[model samples]
Target: MGVKIGLTGGIGSGKSTVAGFWQEAGAALIDTDAIARQLSGPDGAAMAAIAAEFGSTMLTPDGALNRSAMRELAFSDATAKQRLEAILHPMIGARARCQAEAAQAAGMQWIVFDVPLLVESGHWRERVDRVLVLDCSEQTQMARVSARPGWTSSSAASVLAAQASRAQRRACADAVIYNDGLDLAALREHVLTLCAQWRRCK
Candidate 1:
């Protein structure tokens, strides 16, 4: 394959924005979060299983996974979180692998797997050439998430608690982008510079 990169970072870490920059630079991006959203949609492949596992109350009137209710349940109940992960992670991984294969077959020199849980997954490390983490302080995480619609400081903390710590993510990263105070232009410039280097080296 080409330069397969496992892109990950905590919630509110501007990971999505950075992923967009990479995509704009010609990298084929497979985002697990987007896949998860599709799988949890009303007509999603995983909806029936989710409803069966968590009962119908965990679903919305439209038969989709009730994300807010499910999130609350997952945080308050560890077993629920594990069960959800069990149902979703394998499906996400399989889909990602297929997409990566297709991208490589299309002659894409860069394939970026944007996984929010790359470090926690434990299986992605060997599959990728590098792990790129979008780094930011926990405080910044809280602030950024709270700024989003329907999110509060408490919910942000819960999300941060669920993911790997900053140090742990950094420990596993081959590269890190500190996005705490960087503006969009600077961030884009930084990303393009890295893309240039990687392309030349590739």
Candidate 2:
């Protein structure tokens, strides 16, 4: 694909905001999380594999994946998380690549892969030309996450613990957008500038 950019961030860092700007600037965007959820749904290719691996506990009454139960299992056991990733990540990556290729074939100048787990999945590092991180402090992340109804501070902390640390994510970035306190207009302007640079690279 032409100039594939990997966009990622820790929880609540506003990576979606930046991705929106890239979309506005004409870059094709593929959100891996959305694709992953699809792949983990009923009739998904990974369904059989997941069922075989985790057995009936991972299945819902309607015969689909029990996402809530699976989420808890994955978080509680490191091996469960690894097993889930093994079944889902490769499929997600392949789907993302296919979309990017389609965009390139259509003559798009850039493709942005919004992969939240890019830093955690070392295998994905080689798939993109650049990594754009939307940076925010852990405290900010916790606050934003906890403020959501039904989420406790500890629950938010568990989600944060599952991802790569802030320092690790920062180290992987080719460009970083500090998103701790900026307003939407400022964020939009920053993303516009970044997109301009990306287009120039083409």
Candidate 3:
């Protein structure tokens, strides 16, 4: 496909901000979270497998997967998270590949995969031409999450704990975008620069 960049970061680390900048730079973006949500929707292929494995309780009254329930289950049980990933990750990856192929065929300059769990999954490393990490200190992350309308520190901590450590993510990243104290403008500039560099490289 085109020059595919894997954009990732820990929870509340501005991964979405980086992705938005990539979009502004004219890169085709495929967010795995969005694809996962679609695959968990009513009539989606993953719904049947999930129902078969976890029963109807995992589904809502509208026949869609209960996202809140799944979130809680995943956080409380490691096996449950693995089981859900096993059913949805492949489908998400397939859709991402299809999008990347289409973008390449259309002569797009780059494709950005906004995958928050890229390091955790490990399977995506080889699929990407480069790995871009949007990084901030854990303290900054906690502050950002705590300041959100409905977020609590404990919940934020749980989400952070589920992902790869900050040190580990930084160690594996091909490029880093430090967003600790920067505003949106600065973040955009960093992403734009990286996008330019990546485009030139390929």
Candidate 4:
């Protein structure tokens, strides 16, 4: 297998941007968040289970998971969140492993498993060769997320509060990219440098 990197960061920490840089540099990127989104879309693998657990009210008119409604429920109810994870995590893990195996078979030098909750999940550390964390301050996180459409400071705060703290994420990181004030070009340069380092290590 190639160098497997578990890329993670807090919400709005620009983790996706970093992952994009690595993807463009030829790393096979398997994003768990994107997979989860697909699995909750219309006719998704997790949809029937989600509907069964939360009923039709948790689904949209088109039969997709109503993310907004589900998010509200998950945040307010711990059991609801656990139930959702129970349904989705196994599916996500299986898909991710398959993708990684395919990437290794295709002769890829790097496989970047971009997971939002890499540290919180606890099991991800054993699956990946390295943990790459994108770091930024709470204020930066709030500012970035608040600028998005339909997101308020309170909403961003709540989401941030639910994720692992910056300190905890850093503790698990084999490499950290501090993106608090860096521009896109600088971030790309950082990623490029890291990619070279990972290639050398491999």
Candidate 5:
């Protein structure tokens, strides 16, 4: 089997940017968030379960997940969040496993599982060979998120508060990539160097 690396970071920590670099370096990527989104899209695998659990209010006119509504509900109700996760996590995990197996069979040297909640999930550590965390300060995270359209400082702070703390994520990390204050080129260079080292280790 290929080396399975769990890639994670809190919101706006540049985890996606690092994952993109790994992809450029030939690592097969399996993003759980992307899979979850796909599974909640129109006529998606998890839609029926979601609609059943949360009712049609959680679905869009196109029969896809109403993400905004669900987000609101999830933040407002812990039981609702758990119910939604119960419906989606298993499906996402199964699909991710299948895709990882396929990549292994196809002779991929490395398979990066890009999961936003890797530390919080508590199961990914046992599934992957290594955990790579993109580290940044809370202020940096807030700034990055707030800069995005439709996001304010309060919204960014809310997200940051919901996720695992930096210390918590760092404790679980097998490797850490500090992304604060780095430009794209600098970050890419750092990732390239790390990829080289990982490849050599493999």
Candidate 6:
């Protein structure tokens, strides 16, 4: 119902920061990741299915999905990952679309769906009016991710390798923000400029 833009980037590429800027500018953001977090939190809507499928050991003491265990399982076992996705992806998509419809009903002009795997997700390409990619070198991504708490070079590399390549992401983008060395102010400026240009979100 509005100019629904899909904002995306790889890990540590400042995707969340850009989402924040859009939200601060009054765009209704349907953040899939945040919705996933909610679905995995204690007694969440998907928890029952997860426990039923993956066994109760996949849940923590607080009845939340044991992320570390699930992550390990997903990587080592492809079918495990597929099973998990089968449970969560539909839930996330449904919630996101519902929120989006609500945002449109509220007379909002811009609707941003912040999806990290927009390029990899087949259904997302047609769901939005535009796709925005936050472009950065893989080396920059590795360095930024490795600097985070409890992260190491090997782990960062693993995470990067698992995602869709930068080339694939760039190929799918309608616009690209090359975010290598820009400061926060410059980045904010870039987002705002795009917002102004794309502000015709009727």
Q: Which candidate is the best by lDDT?
A: 4
- Please state the error at residue 185 of candidate 1 in Å: 0.6
Looking at model 2, the pairs that clash are: none
lDDT, candidate 5, 37-130, per-residue tens = 8999999999999889989998999999998787678678878877888899999999999999999999998999999999888888899999
Roughly what TM-score does model 6 have, to 2 decimal places? 0.94
lDDT score, candidate 2, position 67:
76
Q: Write the per-residue lDDT of candidate 6 for residues 58-142, one digit (tens) a residue.
A: 9999999998788677668779977888999999999999999999999988899999988877899899999999989999999
In candidate 3, clashing pairs total: 0
Clashing pairs in 1: none
Worst 10 residues of 2 by lDDT: 62-71
| Evaluation by TM-score, superior candidate among 1 and 5 | 1
lDDT values of the candidates?
A: 0.90, 0.88, 0.87, 0.92, 0.91, 0.90
Compute the lDDT for candidate 4: 0.92
Which wins on TM-score, candidate 3 or candidate 4? 4
Using lDDT as the yardstick, the better of models 2 and 5 is 5
Tens-place lDDT digits, model 2, residues 1-202: 4888899999899988889889998889999988987887778778889999999889877667887687678777879988888889889988987888889999987889998999999977798999999999999999998998777888889889888998999999999999988999999999999878766775
Locate the minimum summed-lDDT window of 10 residues in model 5: 67-76
Q: Give the TM-score of candidate 4.
A: 0.97
Model 2: residues with Cα > 4 Å off, grouped in runs: none
- lDDT per residue for candidate 1 within 1-202, as digits (tens), equals 6799888999989889999999999999999999999999988999989988999999889888998898789778989988999999989988988898999999998999998999998898998998888999999999989999888888889989989999999999877889988999999998899889877777
Per-residue lDDT of 39-110 in model 4, one digit per residue for the tens?
999999999999999999999998899877887887788899789989999999999998999999999988
lDDT of candidate 3 over 1-202, digit per residue (tens):
4778899999889988788888989988999998988889888879999999889999999778987677688778889988988999999989988988888989987889999999999888889888998889999999998888767888788888888998888888999988998988888888888777776777
